[model samples]
Target: MAAANDLRRGMAIKYNGNAAIVLEVHHRTPGNLRAFVQAIIRYINTGKSADVRFGSTDKVELVDIERKQLEFSYKDHNGYHFMDPETYDTVTLQENLIGEGRDYLVENLSVQVLYAEGKPVQIEMPASVNLKVVESAEGLRGDTASNVTKPAKLETGKTI
Candidate 1:
């Protein structure tokens, strides 16, 4: 158990008998009122999010979370496939779990997968990825504007 005041983003906790991941946390002290902790958590089972409040001194049950580094293998009709570097085993994740991170996925890319209660919960990608621009319009002559932009398609089928 841990105090509500010690809560931090990305921490997992058991709330109302459900395992949830803390997405955001804020400590607030309203005028003439006791201080409280405000947090936004997403339930692992239902994938639903809720805003909760707890007294500053309240105890919260912490859940164990594990992170594993996996390398991207490929994506087919079955789903996205990843391989564990140490075990040489393949793990397939559904499309819903991949989310927008699919835009940055490439062959042999390393990513972090978060597991809660021995189940995959989230995928963490690097802050930036190097991708090849497969399609883009040619720039016009003297179009060196500082803020100029154009539509481009990445190798992973994401348009930016």
Candidate 2:
């Protein structure tokens, strides 16, 4: 069991019969009342999301989440595949489940895979990924002093 104050961003928790990730949290204080924690929760099962608030008097259970560092191997019609460096075990992560971070994925890049109840739930990439600029214009005018930039496509099919 854990208190509402224990909540944090990216911390996994249980809500309304499913797993949820803590997106944002804020504490509110009033004149008479003490304080409360307001949170934005995203449901992992159905992709339906919502916001929830937990008062100081409210107590909830804190789930233990385990993350492993693995390398992204490849992708296909099946899904994005990741391989464990130590065990050589491979797991497929669905595209839909990757949400908005799909464009940042690259081959053989290390990612943290979150597992709950022995089931793979989330793949976390670095805040910023280093990708080679694959489709940028040749050059504005040689490598001289140029103070302008233009649209470019990264090697991972993402626009930079």
Candidate 3:
């Protein structure tokens, strides 16, 4: 257990009997009352978000989360599949859980998946990822100085 004041974004904690990841946190002190910590949390199971408040000194249950470095194998009708490097085991995750992270996934790309209670809950991506461009339009001759950009399709079928 830890104080609510210590909560930080990306930290998983048990809130209201359910496990949730802290998305945002704010410390506020009202002019007339005691200070409290306000946080925006996303529930892991349902993918729902909620705002919660806690006293500065309130105790919050911290959950132990496991993170694994897995490689992106492929996507199929079932879902996105990732392979454990060491065990060579594969796990398919639902589409909803992959969320926007799918935009950066490519074959053999390494990513960290967080698990709670032996269930995959969150995916942690690196600061940057290199993706192969499958399709791109020819650059305009004089557009270099104007910061022009063009649409591109990646090998994973994601357009940017």
Candidate 4:
């Protein structure tokens, strides 16, 4: 059990009966009442997260999350693929879970994939990735005049 006041950044705890990380915590003290807690939480299991509040003395359970570094291999009809750099183990993640981050992911990019009880929980992509601009337009010498940016295609047949 953990005291509400003991919460810290990155600490995982039960929130609304779901595993969550303590993103932020706020303490509230009124004129004549006991202090309360308000926290922003990110759900651990499903990635569906929200903000919630609790009493200053509220007791909660903590959960530990394990992460592994995996190299992105490729994608096919079976979903996105990743391989553990250490054991050469492979895991596939859903596309919906990847979302807009997919646009920045590149082949062989290293990402941290989280798991709980041997079940894949989340895939954390790197802050940046390098991809070949497959269909970039001919760079006009005067194109640098403005701050405007144009869309470019990647070697993977994706456009940004």
Q: How large an RMSD does model 1 have? A: 2.5
Q: Candidate 3, TM-score vs. the true structure?
A: 0.81
Could you estimate the TM-score for every candidate?
Answer: 0.81, 0.77, 0.81, 0.64
Better of 1 and 4 by lDDT: 1
Count of backbone clashes, every candidate in sequence: 0, 0, 0, 0
lDDT by residue for model 4 (69-158), tens: 888898889889989888998888888546566777778889887665455656677877777787876666777777867788887678
lDDT, model 2, position 74: 91
Model 1 ranges with Cα > 4 A deviation: 26-36
Judging by lDDT against the true structure, name the best candidate.
1
Worst-scoring 10-residue span by lDDT in model 3: 95-104
For residues 42-68, what per-residue lDDT tens digits would candidate 3 score against the true structure?
888888899999999899999998999
- Determine which window of 10 residues in candidate 2 has minimal summed lDDT: 138-147
Which residues of candidate 4, in runs, are more than 4 Å off?
A: 1-12, 20-60, 138-145
Q: How does each model score on lDDT? A: 0.92, 0.81, 0.89, 0.77
Q: Residue 10 of model 2: what lDDT?
A: 75
Candidate 3 deviant stretches above 4 angstroms:
27-35, 45-47
lDDT of 2 at 24: 77
